[model samples]
Target: MTGIAGVLAWIEEHLGIDAAKGGLADAVLRHVKERCAELRVSPQSFLALVERDTTEQEGLVRVVSVGHTWFMRDREQLELVVGRFAGRGPGAPVRIWVAGCATGEEAYSIVLLADARGIPVRVLATDLNERSLSFGARARYGAWTVRGLTAPEREKLATPSGLFEIPERLKSLVTFQRHNLVDPPPRGATGFDAIVCRNVLLYFTKPRALDALRRMRSVLAPGGAIVTAASDVLADGTPSSDSELPRALAKSPTAPPTPVVADLTPPAPWGAEPAPPTKAADAAPVSDAAPREAPAEDGHGAVERARSALDRGDVDEARDLLKAALERDPLSIEGYVLHGIACDASGNTYAAMASFRSALVLDPSLWIAELYLGLGHDRLGAKGDARRCLARGLELHAKAPGLASLSSATQAMLAEGRAHLVEAAAAKLASL
Candidate 1:
């Protein structure tokens, strides 16, 4: 028969709850024993039953999972949200998701703050515990849960009926539902303007936490923000590597638009002969099509200038030039690739990833795009994605016999790409 350790592992796998953590073992043990007693079976048998019966597993999860939270638990985070939304026009649509919203206090707090500031927003509050969600939907809170609020805020938010009850006006702004953070997000939950999942990742193992954070990121709109507890940081205030929140937000969904490369001259037809020079520059006749040709030539020239600037370590100038190049020829694969390189040099890995991905979209066979993309994901602590991209790049690199014929610069890039992949693998192994 299996022992307590076996049962704990089962709980961790099924619920994504690290039962071995402080006090969690006691809580999970108590629930296991309770189930054993009710089922008239031994602990092992109860575990077997839990595995076989989906309802029993869920019941165990509900009993052991924490739902102990109050409104405005992190005032700083709330203030950040308010500050961001304060000046937005009234007609602007704001959507937020409060993941792991235990008993709904956090969800309601967001709505109240937004309403007080005259920001209209819709909040989707989700928890794994149905009982907690039901209580949240009722919008009723005991005195203890309402302790942090100012008297005026409390008075404005709730009507006291034995326990304080949230008014319909505030409650209507939030919708509560049951959700599992480790699983795929529900349909219609994507494209949120913001997602608040503070103080929740601590419950799971690092891998599971990383998975959950990625799921949250998948649903967030481009440039959307995520808030997490300051305690998730290290002594230096940098987020802990084990904590996925910082890594996930590093590549924010709402990245800036792809920069267009500046125009320098009109586009010329391929292999067209240059016009003969005149004694006076103005003596040349102005064709009706000169305006159109000017932009394309200018774009090509800007791309060349950007590459030169990049070679000179002038990332800012390179970026400016590439912006104009892309603006002139949005489909220019070389422009996007060079822009990605500039972004990487500037330490903007997120923007670099976006730029590289855009290049790949334009030309999937671009040799170095996957390499840089993998490196970007590696920096973000998305090891799985990083490994996948690197592997694909390496595979393509292996099949290309023309590497020997490429320019010295291209050959150097291939060497650098391989080094990055090797370093990433080493880092992953060291962590393990």
Candidate 2:
């Protein structure tokens, strides 16, 4: 890890932000370079200073992270919470926790809606970014943040001082705190009626995310549930009321799952694990067996064991298992994909690309392989390959519904859209 890669890793560590997602890698590199020029220091020196200085780390993270949220961002979810409260007799004020409450819009929005229905509420809003917490604490915002509300609604809720300021009544109902979801919950952070953690967990690594979800679950009152973005697919056990949320968590390309002793869920994404290899060519017996009671690599369960290794953060094991799996099932496209993900995880760029290339050799039009190859190429500064692969990926998944049809591993890697990845590729194209 050095240069751009090292800095991106640092950002992911300190800020708990996925620097690789949604063109964030390019953004971080550009920001660091510009900051280096402004500060009159080399990139290496700047990173060193940031490593030791808490203030610098916070400042750098503030500039690089994205929290593009607004009031009533998901109105349906809010309504669901408010309606639940209205049904209950007066006992305790509805205690709502707005985890990752960016800029406080969502927090304040909760209060305003509850008030409309004459339900009392108290809200605790938290985020990892200090800058965002500071902004939320101000209780003021630009008009663009309130675009969801009509003019009459906006006027009723905010004071116009060239900026939309929430009235003190609403502001007093909410408290803003700086918090990293990866860490344990703030002391005594418990007994919440609702937890609105939307569009936030998608960036977290699997282990860190599960930890956060566990903490959030501890704070929930009886019958209280978490409302998350549709895209977030949490691991099994922790429950949420959001019907749109996926039942099982999938792998994020960069962050594999933490080790679990017993994982009963099918090891494939959204219950769509690849079928047993059909061709006689694919029936080649597994040459090398993995540790423990796991079956040989050629078996269907080989993918399952590899997925298990990923859960344990043992990419080396995963890579080996995938290798034997692919060897046994030469025509298995998903085998090649899993192999590529494991190779990428182990930082073997050449082997990773080969795995993806092998998939392409099998089927030139495979969107999963082409898309990841482009993302991996962009990260390693292969601009030409990134541009070509991403263009094809974006064209293949142009339809909204098709995105969901991809395997779990592919979906997890694609935290955002092909367009987002393509824009980063385009940036590299311009640089070239």
Candidate 3:
């Protein structure tokens, strides 16, 4: 009874997968058609199959995934971990989980690094895509995957066929498995010394990602850590829209001092994400205290400078500064809204709308972002989207108490930089 739009909504809600910007939306359509042909069913009937079978619905995760990976693509974290474990010399082989291991390059890279450091490690590599896992399990990689190895390192892994065949010794250290990270870690997969989920959480919605991180923390041995690509994190080492929102999410007694440690960059990390959770008021309010870097020189500083440039009517300067600031801190909600405004002032309505959407993706409660986004949509002649955004913004802004009663977990999310959202939303709606 549902079409493609409804199907996508289902996937986004259930699995927190946003196929829109990743070019996977079209792949969904293609996958549906292919499955229908394979099953000799109509599109409607295929939708029925997707609903009845969990496996059918889960297939979309694979559909959206690409397995283009080379060894040591992002190796700093791997090297760091090897050095740490090598020095500690845990009596037994250290256990590591490589989530979203595309075609085994990262997992194999970890093994080689640890081998070179004279430490033993057991890597449990996983991916939703079975094809990639199977390829990894084979322990044979093309020259590209081996290009990063030093001549001495390359000499150790000799193959008559010229492909880099992992030696049985190194191959023995890794185990490949099919897994869905959104679910709990597989059985026999507890108490890891470290978990390396590189650049993978960027594919997850914020809350969904946090949920996975919490799960990862549960299985980590005391003093163990979770490693992620540097670009994959937010201001405080998590991919939260509001810099302060995940403070509660980051807390745990048995976990390592820092649950998350980032590495490489996350790929174009803003478009769509989960909506805000039901607001809670029973918990005590948490004081704002995450990593507040250089009040005069960091993201906060850049945003203030951009504001000054805008007041001086220099839209270009403001936009450039805002862009740079956002590049450094994508979780800066103020920077995003201001960037949208600057874009609009520069007559780049589309970019303005995208910037506003990015803001909403982090914190939908931002009535200001919704109102401005609606305005952008209106300028683009998209009446339906304009009405939806405007109405939501106006409705949220109408709440009498207005974003003040945040729970201990999220009080820090919007506590700062208020006093303007309500005034602006109300003024815009009244004018309209």
Candidate 4:
């Protein structure tokens, strides 16, 4: 094998990471070069050391694996965990394992949520990287990690450092450990009440991923649930069997069931909308109103449902429902707008922009779409686009009727949008 190929093979065999399947081969090579430079060793020598030394192999895996995660990364799944155990009496401890916990944002988020809701729970957070576990133990994070938190939530749990430091109480609820999913369950990891393994399986080949899934399933307590990425669904578009968190574990060891996989894929924006049907040559064209009215009703219903899902912090469900709404009526302005909101909440800025742009295409009068589109652009660091869109939205809002005339939700959205716009402008000026 070529040198790079041989190294990649080693990574897969030892780390259970299929570099090519993970689309991270290039990144792994880059990390290898950086590591070699840091150690003052030749590439060949470094590779030899990694082969011979277990510690070096572990360090290499840590460097190659991306740990880009944040607090409340998937709010809906967190809510599910809370809802399940919050009301239970203290007879049995609510056990949760955050597999691939990556620096502890997800694990700590769970602990914080449980405390806020008065749930008595214990969290075991494990990852393959020892350095990441050490960082999690520190419980300090940059502001970007806590962006989704409300002011009250931030004040209650964090104190300001160069980066925010999580309160000791929250940190005390979780135990971080070094563990690998490709291996057997670590001691004391069995019978968890809930297991959260989001966004981790995509790193392996299908066979390896299945093996990891089976291992994860084996450790669950009877009726315990495992939550994963929504994209991990079955071919039929229904949530895979793994998503049934409340289902009782089967008696047979060989009958390993699937875990709940939450979908995080952004809904397709307006550009992918199907074209309208052509009119018959012999018949006069139908009035635009009749065709428009029917779809509008369907779209409105769907958007309303999406809004309800969002209210409950079920972002995946909201996005899925919005996708159906848009499919039913491509020109549904409200559907596109609501979909944009869901995408923004889920950290999908580009998709959010596309959804907002689609809404504007359907109705240029939608000031809300412009406002959200601007916020999305700002998050993506498109300063010029952000400024123009925000300016236009604000101008439109000023010309509209009194704020008392709008719905409470719309009022809230407008206020939040304005705040983001001002923040973006201030940031731009600070850089000058």
Query: Candidate 3 on 128-239: residue-level lDDT in tens?
Result: 6655666788887544346557777767775665556788888988887766666766555666777787655655556667777776766666556677643354323544
Write candidate 1's Cα lDDT for 155-180 as tens digits. Answer: 76554343567888878888776667
Once all C-alphas are superposed, what RMSD does model 2 give against the true structure?
A: 16.4
Per-residue accuracy of model 2 over 1-432 as CA lDDT, tens digit each: 465666777766655556554335655676678778888988888788778877666555544433344567656556665776787788778887777775688889889899889998988787666556777888866554575566677788555344567888888888776666656555556767677776565555456566666666666666666766543543342322223332232123244332211112211111211122121110000011122243453545676677677655466577777777766778777667778766654334445677889888877666666767876665444678887886776566554324443367655544543334444334433434
Total backbone collisions for each predicted model? 25, 1, 7, 8
Please list the residue runs of candidate 2 whose C-alpha ends up more than 4 Å from where it truly belongs after superposition.
158-162, 234-432
Worst lDDT 10-window in candidate 3? 280-289
- The global C-alpha lDDT for each of the candidates, from Candidate 1 onward, is 0.60, 0.60, 0.61, 0.61
Residue 353 CA displacement from its true place in model 2, Å: 32
Per-model TM values vs. the true structure: 0.53, 0.54, 0.53, 0.56
Candidate 3 segments exceeding 4 Å error: 33-42, 53-59, 233-432
Better of 3 and 4 by lDDT: 4
Report the Cα RMSD per candidate: 26.8, 16.4, 19.2, 15.9
Q: Give the per-residue lDDT digits (tens) of candidate 4, residues 249-281.
A: 321233233347322221221121112211100
Off by over 4 Å in 4: 34-45, 160-162, 233-432
